[model samples]
Every structure is written in C-alpha cells, then in structure tokens.
Target chain A: MSTLIVIDQAPYGFWTGREALDMAFSLAAFDQPAAMLFTGAGVNWLRKGQRPDGVGQKSAEKNLSAAPLFGIEALIADEHACQQYGLTESTMLPGVELVSNIRDVLGDHKHVVFAG
Target chain B: MSASNLPERNNEGFLEYATDWSSDVASVIAAEEDVSLSDNHWEIIEFLRKFYNKHEMSPPSNRLFVKAVKDALGEEKGNSIYLMQLFPGTPAKTACKIAGLPRPTNCL
Candidate 1:
C-alpha cells in the first residue's frame, strides 16, 4: 500500500521532534511506497541556511535535508501555504515539489497520515 | 507574553513539551541530510540537552559548542572539529528541535 505523510509544522526548533521523523521513516521502511508533504507551519522545516547557533541541538535544516536519503523524497509543498509563511521555492530543499494545494497531493495516495 | 509562548506541561507537571527524538525519529533522520545519526549522535544530543537545561538556551557556535560538550561529556568526546564535522548543523538547532522547545528566533 502506498502511504503519504504530511508534516504540518516547521521541521526546525518549533517541532522537529522524534515522532515526526520516526513516523515518516517507519512508513517508508514498510516496503510500501511513501511520500512527505510539508505544509502550513511545517514549511519552515525545509528552509535553507538554518544554522542553530546558540541553540542546544544540531541544525534542524540539516536533519531535514537528510529525509530524501531515507526514501521519503516526495516532499510536496502548497504554493499558497509557502506565501503565507513568507517563503519561496529557493528556501526549501531541492527535491521539494510545490503543488496547488493539499487536496491535489492527497488525491494520489492510498493512505495519508498527518504529522503535526 | 502570549499564552502560546508558555511552555507545555506534561502529565508529570514538568515542562514536558520538548519533543522526544526516539529511535522512531531516526528513520527520517537520513532523508533530511546525507549524514547519519549513529550512537555517537545520541551522545551529542544528550550533551546538548544538559547544556540547555543548565543555561536555559542553546549553545553558541562551535567554540562554545565544543566547550559545552566537553564540560557536559568528557575530553574524549569533546573534539571540537570532530563534533562539528559529525553534526553539520549548529548544536543549538539540533538540540532545540529534539528538546521540543520553541525554536529560537534569535539564531541567524
């Protein structure tokens, strides 16, 4: 079965907890097809140049950048959502595909999981 | 400050809002970057957590990052350049994310 994971929070310091990463990868490892969608606040997770200086942990951007290697490369972002968040295509990871909206991307998956 | 800015409370009544970076979180770790989070990565995560708990903020750049790690961990694990290379992201970024605290807006 194909799976779709939607990350709706910024992947940085705001909400880059282990639960988000764990779900995204566990679904991918099932041997079933899987993809991740970054929308709303989640779009911040993909922003480039995220240096977490003075923060206790490693960089959120770097950890997010590694998502594709785990086979969760299907990063779809909503164009409208990006604008709302004051972001552009250039700010995200290279493979991230911008779509018209959530429904358009959701239409393609067999199972969808929303990760906040 | 807005109530939203207030820290979350867990069942234990402690500020338990920090997200847990369990083994489950590791699955997606590789997709975000080329680097992998091995056992050593956990060590750094723990070290970073201690520093944050003590200082109530993220560590600065590599200079202070290494020092904090050494102070928290030990000289053997406190190799500055090695830590930097292993964790491409600044310690603050990684540590804060794992801790589940609000993202530090101050970092550039």
Candidate 2:
C-alpha cells in the first residue's frame, strides 16, 4: 500500500510544514511507500534558494534536501498556486512535479495524511 | 517489541529527544533565537491537526499557513513575519518541530 502526504504550508516559516515533512520522511524511513502532494501555500516549500540563518535554527532546507535519500521522490507542487504566488518553474527546486491541483494526485493513493 | 513497545517517553527528556538545532549542546544555545511558543503556535498546531484530519497529508509550503492566519486573524495579522514573531526559534520549521510534527521537506 502507498501513503499520500499532503503539504499546504511553506517550509522554514511554520511548524505545520516541518512536521508534515518529518512524518513523510519518517514513514519513508520505516520502509513505507509514500508520495507527497503540494497544495495552497505548500508550494513555497518547493521554491529554491532558502536562507534561514537570519534566525538561529538549523536550516529546515536540509530536511527537504534529504527526501530522496529516504526514498521520497514523489514531491508534487501546485502550478496555478505557484503562478499566483509569483513562483515560476525555474525558481523551484529539482525533482518537483508541477501539477494543477493536489486532489488529482491524492486520488491515486490509498492512505493520505495532512501535515499542514 | 510489543504493539505498545513502551510509553512514548516520560516527558522528562522531551527537550533532549527533540532534534538539536546546533551541534554543540554543552552550553546554552542562546535564547536570542528562541521564541516563546504562544496561542498562535497552538493555532497553527491545531490547524495542522485539522488539515491532517481532512486530507490525511502534510502541509506543503507556506500557502495554507498564510491563508489560515489570514482567515483566523485578519490580513494584517497573517504574515510570515507574525509567525516568526510568535514562534521564537525559526518561524515555520522550528515551530513545527516544537509542535511535535515531522520535519518539513525541502528545508534543513
């Protein structure tokens, strides 16, 4: 069975995104099949070039970068929302699937969890 | 290990079990970056819970966050700046860790 994780929050800006990603990676680490769907504000996480040093916490970007290592390559993002947020395809990180709505991806998965 | 391997934790080592932001844990990690977890933090936490309940998924970027804040508190009050202000450490990622959720992808 496959697990679907949905993200609608931005990384490094809120706890929701962080927790959600952690859960996704943890699930993957535990040897579960999983895919993440990005919606709403979650698309910002895919945006490349994050510099959170202004504060003092470890860069949340590191977690995102480790997804593939844990076998979590199904990173999806919302294209329309990205356009609305002024984010273009060129600005997103590598391995992101620009989709119309996350629901389409959600439809294919058996188990889904929301972390935003 | 049984289904219930052990009590998750006694709460004594909650802080210790948390992911260390810095490598050196010998000394105080400077409160300058830490922010007090507040109602706003809870609000986001609850939002994450509901979000999970509805979609059974994790939050993506910051879209749901800004939207939720704007919806709950007015537009003026709903910004990444406010999230950062309320949650002392790092705005989104750190606060989420404190909230006991998983680490967000794409952030480190």
Q: Write the per-residue lDDT of candidate 2 for residues A1-116, one digit (tens) a residue.
A: 68988887776667887777778866764567888887887877777666665865445555576565456758887888888888887887778888886667888889888985
**lDDT by residue for model 2 (B6-72), tens:** 2132232112233332222211221223544456556665654454333233433343345445665
C-alpha lDDT of candidate 2 relative to the true structure: 0.59
Q: What tens digits encode model 1's per-residue C-alpha lDDT throughout A1-116?
A: 46788777765445544466556655544434678787887777778777665676556566555455445647788888888988887777687888876897788888888875
Q: Which lDDT tens digits does candidate 1 get at residues B34-105?
A: 456777876776665555544343442344455556665788777766676665665444444544433432
Q: How high is the CA lDDT of each candidate model?
A: 0.59, 0.59
How accurate locally is residue A36 in candidate 1, as Cα lDDT from 0 to 100?
77
- Show where candidate 2 strays beyond 4 Å: B1-108
Place model 2 in a CAPRI quality band: incorrect
Model 1 has an lDDT value of 0.59
